[model samples]
Target: MKDYDDTTWFLGQWGRFQQTVFFLLCASVFPNGFGAFSLVYLTDIPSHSCLVPDVNLTQDWHKAIIPIKVVNGKQEWSSCSRYRLDVVRNLSALAYVPGRDVNLTDLELEACVDGWTYSRDVYQSTVVSEFDLVCSDQWKQPFTSTVYFLGVLVGSFFSGQLSDEFGRKPIFFGTMAVQTVFTFVAIFSPSWTVFCILLFISGLGQISNYISAFVLGTEILTGNVRVLFSSLGVCLAFAFGYMMLPLFAYFLRDWRSLLLALSLPGLLYLPLWWFIPESPRWLLSQGRVREAEAILREAARKNKLQAPQIIFDNYHVDADETEKQPKEHLSIFHLLKTRNIRNTTVILCMVWFTLSTGYFGLSLNTSRLHANPYISCFISAAVEVPAYISSWLALRYLPRRISVICILLLGGVSLYFIQLVPQSLSELSVALEMLGKYGLTTGTALMFVYTAELYPTVLRNTATGTCTTVSRVGSCIAPFLLQLSTYLKYLPYITLGTLAVASAFATLFLPESFGRPLPQTIQQMYRRESSLKCPFITRKKPSKAVVLSESKL
Candidate 1:
């Protein structure tokens, strides 16, 4: 609510620099967090097919009907299991394994496959028509990637609190340094278990870096710009995240090398810290009005403008211990207890869970030594851009509920078609993913921006963080659900699609939140909804000439 229009420094070049650095800094998340998430598409899983052979299984020994176990994407157990069965067939076709070990292979090795396969999603996939790698059953995939997401969930939940308490710049730099250090440890871990453990821990650090970028970005802009571009920042980062995905997969060549390549972005961002300024908004919020004033003066000095006469303490920040002793007590825990808040959380979480599972589910499965993993990744990422553009349009022009409903519906129906599509037009398989991507991406972005807008600023950070946490709970399950259905890929998509639609419909009960100032309480939100639909109520303005005549009700 504080206006910096009087602050002469924010009016020119410094403002532009601040906005530019904010975006570039957030771009680091792509190479750090998302690169790990997309590792499934890039990692090579040992695969074999009962139906086809792309490599010479006989070079090692004569094989026919080789059950090749191909590790497509990150090496998880579900992928391993499918790869193991397929590998054995191809191994047997070239030269069979001892007959007795087949049972042992299935039993003793199931754990290994599970280790490689258990993603956060529930459904799973294996080599069927497209993917055809035939080689060593051993594939290197880091389980630490899941741990990284767990870390992200935690870091994102608390970044606002920590950055506000500490300083935005410190948390940002510290977390990036941590990411660099742990990434090196993971790259050189002697054992896979040790590596995964470190990877999980690294995620906690990497996630906070993303949060710092968001907070800093918001603080740098005016209200009108903040509403549009802050949301645009996420879209840009994600779009670039998806675009970088295929590029990384194409270059890194191996999981370790790929990870090492991903870590280099930290170094790219580290140099930026020197030029980046502390958030003036956060400085005021933390009661460091003097420092806020100094920073504003610095920005003005950099822009060659004089500081305005405005005092540093002029802006009122509603947060912190003194002014907020009791008023800050919207009670973060209370959000869970209220029926409306609870409903909003559940609906949002369901959408996030389904979108990730459906989108990542299909795309990840189709990567790694397919007819073309690069082509597949490119197509899927390409489809999602439209989703982002569509969302930006929806936010710009349409009502919240209707716009959300349309995308969710498109995504849901498209999912069902995946079950019936002809593989000959095989590209359509990935094309359908757009439906889910468009819906889920739009919903998630909208939910984050809208959730903050719905709650009072006192608990705005808490509400958005809590909502993201619920979505993370869903993310924790996406890997498992995604891999569970290797034998039946369509089932998971269908179920996820349905859940997305249902969540969209559920959202209808919540009122629209466009152009209105955020409500100070859940009670305020409800009262406003009621006022809009007040029955038998009409107001007529008396003509200008009759303004002097007062009416008594």
Candidate 2:
């Protein structure tokens, strides 16, 4: 059969057919963007303190029940602990002040017997507020995000294989339905435990839909357009969607309403199933020649181009031979089988891990930044637009290795210096943190196209899926990393910065892929040495005259 790229004979590359598919696939990514990070707002811990029960007492006596505790060297009302109820009741009846009538230091402390009262200045309702997920129960907040990411990890591991075995279209539609339905269902979750379980199932479909769309685009498009679509097109859509999330959260105020707003858009995507065609290349690879031909012709007709009467006529291969071909089950193991492949796989996974940690770490920490959470989130998502644009340009013009390294290095440096910004200038600290986020976001966009170019088509999905699965470990750790801020304010930034720097160095071992044809098979990766080296660095062959003179011929 004719190569998929040779479709120029019957259809135009940048014509109606490709653009139609590209935009629709990108539209699907809009929801995936916000869905990935919604936990930041949904589970946010609002200002909370121990609830005081009904009692006839002076205002001072009521104030004495909840004692102030030192946090970060500053005194704030304790959320978890309170003064003994009996002592407080007796003191209130006597109109006693702690320091005046009783020794304040001698008052016994006890855990919050009454449920907490949450401040509703920002959030009207949240899982943290609704379920009292503060103080002792605070651990559950991060665990919720971790559980969601665990689902992503499991989905990423298997989705690619399932897509490869079945058609991309089926997995795409299936996951989209799962993502939409479950996310909406989660709003009515009976308990925090049920909400988390629904979140996990939603998470499962989220990454799978994204990966399915990504692979479909890579397989269907050709040359620079493919790079453009992968780096900027879908990524930009995601960024825009993420930017809108703050507006939703800001207006909704209630977590359940915000979730409903996030999920309701998925209904608009159902019609996409009819518009998107299956990957014709996959059909050909499966020896379904007639089915593949129909798709190509339909594409040509849609593009308003002339048709070749016989599309795969010149291609000659026996159907029996195709059936007899070895059905090798490609797995992540295939990535580690060879020397060069093993080295490449290890480095790529590390790069993915570091990039993801920085991205999610910053994304999740917007609430902690000394600014309006809505504004912080908007700024965070807004920077990704320019980052993605630069990444798209770099993918086209610059060597992939240098592009990734420079972006990551900048991110690492920006993160490292955040601690040096004086607390008096909280704005400067937020700006520096955003600068680091910009760098990491750029690197993230670049890595998607870079990894796709590195792996051959046969193993491309498996490799990308494996790398993304490893990256989820970073995402899963991000919540806990933010939790470390309670111990040392700058710990998460320092940790992410350190990882970004280390991964930049690790990226040096990877070969550059710029203006070179994508590897088609595992064998091609092993046989081709020059294809794998830095494009800007090369050894010069000796000139013929110099060789003759040196030989004294």
Candidate 3:
């Protein structure tokens, strides 16, 4: 019954930094995903910032120092004029100056001659209107926006096996480093199509790295602390990440600049090579005893405790002592053949799919709700802040099933409410719709934690990948489904709500896994999955590391 010090326990285990990794990882994607996505609309803000250096005047000194006198003939170096210089230094200050006295650059002076001045006009007057995605082909827009999630689907399948065979730490860093490169490339794409293609590449890295990060988290730490660091930590990283987009956009304007600003931080993780340790569980799985022993010894040293006389490297867990379970191999296909894990997978997948669609659908639909679209969108997202705390509390008391069911049901009902409400109330209607949006967001957090817990260790990441992939399928469909709502009225929300309900109900069959040992195989998941009411994880007093030939290991 030995445990490491609470402070140094998770602190030593590489997984403790999962939140750090997730926050960093999420930071890497947001500039492109949230930044680029939000920037398409906000990009014009910088063009506003790119105004003439000195054109801000409201008062009039005299009638004749007009823009024509400033940089009229200086079209070649128009931005270098005295007016431009003054404007750059004191834009707001010039507002008090006489209008006639204020000078403008060549283009500005030309627009000013007839008092037909249009401020902030470099991109195009029609630029904002281009959003009339009504007629314009969005072939690349939809793909670029979601290609990362799709890449997750693909990466999850292979990353799990890679993590299994190659080890978590390497794949984790490898994928992230590669992802960082693509993320940079994604930022520079000339068009949305290229951006999306690059993001697709980065997405592969994002999902696989995520699995490895979690592998690190689960390998180290024990007790409630382990649970907290692994689950709530990731949940918070996403919540905080969503919250920061507007802030990042506010400070950094150029979409490309913003993307680079966000991505360059990932380079910070490269130095993490020396700090984080390889997963002890993964090490044990590979029968790398000497390595696992070294890691365990370090864990003991960090916590100032002695390593157990003999570290049990075998898959056998003694229920009498540690309540550990016997290991079983669970293949991806075998997940479907098994009843409980299969059931959990289906329900989790549905829940994941519905939430991804609903969350993105609402994000896409904000403009449909108001006059000041960005303002409305900002407030709508603000409401999700409380859900993360509520979800954390809910996880503490309620089981994942109840939490998920309630959240998804809430989402379903909320979506229904969105269409049911009259559009006349305007802002209030958007807020109501956002209630469901927040629910879907919360449901998504629940799914990430709940799904990762269902399978045995070997298949966990693979299972997580499967869940991630299925959800991306839902995300891929959301743009079309959400846009279709304009023609069909309540169809998209209603369809997503129905799916949420089905996903919620699927939880009924899954054994609530809270406060149980993480299952490591399909057989363990089925016949005797319950830790609350189980027979024995081990029959003997956990013998020495069981030697396994290549056939066994």
Task: Estimate, for each residue in 345-456, the C-alpha lDDT of model 2 and write its tens digit.
Answer: 8999999999888899899988867458888788888989999999999988998888999999999999999899887998888888988999999998898888887886
- State the lDDT of candidate 3 residue by residue for 148-201, as single tens digits: 567766777777777766777888888888777886776656654566677677
Best TM-score goes to which candidate? 2
Q: Which candidate number would show the highest lDDT if scored against the true structure?
A: 2
Scanning candidate 3 in windows of ten residues, the lowest lDDT window is: 542-551
How does model 3 score by TM-score? Answer: 0.71
Q: How many residue pairs clash in all the candidates, one count each?
A: 61, 0, 11
lDDT of 2 at 59: 85
Cα-based RMSD of candidate 1: 9.4
Q: Report the Cα lDDT for residue 524, model 2.
A: 45
- Cα lDDT of candidate 1 equals 0.56
Q: What is the lDDT of residue 2 in candidate 3?
A: 18
Q: Assess every candidate by TM-score.
A: 0.72, 0.92, 0.71
Summed over model 3, clashes come to 11
Winner of 1 and 3 under TM-score? 1
Candidate that beats the other on lDDT, 1 or 3, i.e. the better one: 3
The lDDT values for all models are 0.56, 0.82, 0.57
